[model samples]
Target: MPGETVQPTPPGPAPVPVPGTLVVDTSRGDRLGEFRGAAGPYWSLRAVCGGVEWEAEPGAVRRATRKERLHAEIERWNARSRGEVL
Candidate 1:
């Protein structure tokens, strides 16, 4: 271990705040959430339907086009239902 280099663990997901546009994730059967800032090292998002909130790691906030975002959101919803968090 003396010569080994330890890399710091990466941070949690951050919200990519897109103001004023309502995003619907049909795959999840629910609407995509709104950005509500960070909670500790995790980024928080508030799903409009039923007011459900969730946090994701920072890697999730990578810049994406509108179409990419929508596709990602749909995939996210599907993943969530399958007990997988992206």
Candidate 2:
């Protein structure tokens, strides 16, 4: 339609993280994941306990804090103990 306004998509954050780096995806309730690599315009990340990878917008993810990292490690350990992961 004429005279209609359009909103451009916002740009995502820069400085992509390296593979195996832990990051929190704020878009997904701050789920922690291990950075896998880039997936076109998005970044790929896998759960700490090891599962299917998920893509997230770069702007929605940030490096995990020390506390978050520790928690993820413990979660992984617990999962392994329960045979949830090998």
Regions of model 1 farther than 4 Å from truth? 1-31, 67-86
lDDT of 2 by residue, 1-86 (tens): 99999999887567988898999999999999999999899999999988899999998999999999999889988998898943
Looking at candidate 1, the ten consecutive residues that score lowest on lDDT are: 20-29
lDDT of 1 by residue, 1-86 (tens): 89999999986544445543344333344435555666787656665333566665555444335875677568668877988644
lDDT of each: 0.56, 0.92
Candidate 2: misplaced stretches above 4 Å? 1-12
Instruction: List TM-scores for all candidates, in order.
Output: 0.36, 0.76
Number of clashing pairs per prediction, in order = 6, 0
Superposed by TM-score, candidate 2 places the C-alpha of residue 29 at a distance from the truth, in angstroms, of 1.2
